[model samples]
Target: MKKLLFFYFLLIGFYTYGQVGIGTAMPDPSAQLDVTVAAGDKGVLLPRVALINTTDQTTITNGNVESLLVYNTATQNNVTPGYYYWYNGSWRRLTALGDHPETITTLVNNTDGSYTYTSEDGTMTTFTVGGMMVDNGDGTYTFTNPDGTNVTIQGVSQALTILSYDNNTGMISYIDENSTLTQLDMSLAIDSWETLTDLKLNPDNIHLDYTDEDGVTNQIDLTTLVQNLETLTTIVANADGTFTYTDENGNATQIDISNLETLTSLALNADGKTLEYTDESGTVTTVDLSSVITNFETITTLVDNGDGTYTYTNESGNTTVIDVNNTETLTELVLSTDNSTLTYTDENGNDTIINLKTVVQANQKTTTLADGVNTTVSSTVSGDNTAWQVNVATAKGANNTQNSTLGVVKEADSNPTVNIANDGSLSVNLENTNDIKEVSGNYTVLPNDTILLGNASTADVSIVMPNPVGKKGKTITIKKQDTNEDYYINVYGNINGLSQLYTALPYSGWQLTSDGTQWKITNKF
Candidate 1:
């Protein structure tokens, strides 16, 4: 029996190691393939496949492979529940299909149903299910293990479409319900610059509290904004970070600058009027704007004349000169007393004279008398040797009347008295009446028509003698007989103190007459 068994083992080794046709004998397991094997030939030894895994093993046969490849063979679905493949001299076993779940991590979900797959070796591949493909935008996708470790799948340009990304990494992906496509968290969007809003930044923004070019203020709180402007159109932050805004009509405006010390230039157009600026020192100055302005409709120019007066001239050539604070209009003119003449010059340049005289006469005038005219007065004498003179001192004089008792001639005791009337009539009165006395001698009245008086008061004595008297002996005598003795007197005087003689008796009262109207006299002694 032993000899028979040795021979049996040898024959089985030969059949196993050598190649056999479809009709060749079956070989034992430990033998090399007796089949004709070429270099780079890949075929299965049927006994080696069955010997390594007695229940389940993969085998390769020559007639079933093309050239040197081993084609398909049935899997050991019911045998040892393991994986095996025939190669070299043995069959190798693999873990069963359910040994562990496939370690698949979903990195990106494209719009297509295709998924990108990766193995434990870090080898990457794409698998499709239900004829779907992913469009990964920018030709890339991410593959991840189940634990979220990621490997990038690039060159997906034509294969997959990207839908969203991780909020933090910005990794892109295809859309899937299971995939988290996070943008910036909506809560963190406040810090994100891409999504800013007017509602979010208006009253809360410090930059909005600002001013504009026009010196108007703008956007603060809504209450402050309304206080600044009724409404606004737009707001802009300058490069200096100062804020300014526009109105509804898009006009840039500013608020009044309360503290304007920093202003370098101010632009104001107050044409046709004076521009006044008041500084902090309470000094006011008027800006010279004549060259910059065209019309000064309400402006008034006042020029000062050093004498506390001013002159104003309008566009029309009318000028008004005013005393500084006096309200009187200049009308009346007074020429000083030193001025000799007052000349009035009219518009035609003609002068009219108005001269002042020394003194003015109203009615009376003074004049001198005409030459050769005579003035007369009636003069009378009342003493002895009375005479009348023509043109004596002060035009006329009268001497005393005749008195023969003493026979002494003297001037009139009183000044000659004359009475004259405006009608050229004259009258005379003797100023020395006591100088007349009784004549007791023969005192001849010259021219010889005389009578010596007896008592003419009791006797009517009238003497009418000759018209022509004797030249050598003109004589007269008188005798007194009432006494007891004879008394004789004679008074006669020559014409030239030698021939004429006259006498008169003593009488208490006497009278002489020559036609009572011409010459008549009476003496009482």
Candidate 2:
């Protein structure tokens, strides 16, 4: 009776192909222990193991239980309390989400005409250019290159491997080490026989090459004839994150760059926040140079604070008030080997002295001597010419002045008229030509002489002007005092050896100005 009950409890009656079903007599042929649940019934129940925290998960690793499911009692970082399944290397959250899509299938022709191939990860690829092989109905395939080169492969069981390459032009495809995806419309050759890091364009030339372990480069050849490129095409920038290019036939094509992640691709945008540049592939690439490039200097304008400071904008647009304390101007500075004593030459060639030693020595003092238009001060500001005067006087002394002078005076009327020798003298008494007016007919004028031609002479009188030896830019004025006198006065001491003759009209005047070597009549009536 126990044996009969055991048989009934286990199978109920039907058993086929060593399979059993709980709710249904007929079991799935593919499953050994198939259980069919009725509607509204709970699904399969997995073993429950609660983890208080993530650290406890380490203990479960001892068992070679891959794909084992477990529930978390607490949250871990951003992960919430949920069921996680052991995956290839880590725990993956399992939710009642959509299932993975079936692998997209593809057909590829190999060197062998009669062959089939599947990628490492069963994925679909449609290559339109570079080189393509056609599968002949008779187990043979023909591969044609852009330059009209062809190759035949025997029927094989594997898929044809493909890679990307870059031509000098923008039509190219390849991924860089940085996970950058590139596409190319140019001719390229790919093979599964060798692992290729990249088929990139050389920076110095248009050739693409492969670098070996020994750092040697092998030229990668491609078909030079590109029938797709019948015309010249170039890419341009648009408001949207896409590249605009006109095909050789002049058809406009827009390439989506919205998925691109960096500012290195400025055709994408270049507003300080973004930038774009052509990479080694002859393709424009962009990286988020924002962290790399910035308006840190662009949005900034300098403002000179009325104080000795200035203000400029930092990247934040906030004003940064800073004194120019971190800069030095080397106009004509000469420093000692120890950088202790420094010398500065001003515009006027006067030097300023800085004795670093004097900073600590009471007797030694820092001295600076500069000459301003009307003043000269050292290490201090002054409106008076004291500092300049001292330098000038010291330099202009008996042996200091530009030109040395011996006490040789050019006497005028008498009274030591003009003392050429400024020996120990601080003042020069100038001859007063304002009060003296002499009546003269014709005579050569002296240095300090003032003459008035009042008498009318019958003969043509020649009046010689004074020699302008030491005089520069000095003017001489002569007036006919008598109104009734009309005399013909001839003048000399000019470049032409004859001055502009003055017709003595009453109260008329003749003025002669000297240009050091020659005298010219400036005013004549």
Best by lDDT: 2
The residue ranges of model 2 lying beyond 4 angstroms of the native Cα positions read: 1-414, 418-425, 432-435, 457-460, 495-500
Model 2 scores worst on lDDT over the 10 consecutive residues at 291-300
Number of residue pairs clashing in candidate 2, backbone atoms closer than 3 angstroms, sequence gap of 3 or more or interchain: 40
Q: TM-score of model 2 relative to the true fold?
A: 0.20
Q: Tens-digit lDDT track for model 2 on 304-407?
A: 45454545444345564544333333234455555456565543567888663443232322445667443445443467223333322222225567575433
Q: Cα lDDT of model 2 overall?
A: 0.51
lDDT against true structure, model 1: 0.36
1-525 in candidate 1: lDDT tens per residue?
999999999998876556544323543344443443346556654332222243323344332222222222444444343445444544445565776686433333344754443334444444333322233576766554323345565564334333543433324345444453422221121122122123223544543545443446566565665444232234333454243434343345332322222211111234633434333333444444342222212113445565644454443444555442322211211222444333433334455554422111112133333323343334456873334443312323334534322322233354534445566465554432212323343333434323343223333232223322332233322222222123433322222223322233443222323332232223323
TM-score of structure candidate 1: 0.17
Compared with the true structure, all predictions reach lDDT values of 0.36, 0.51
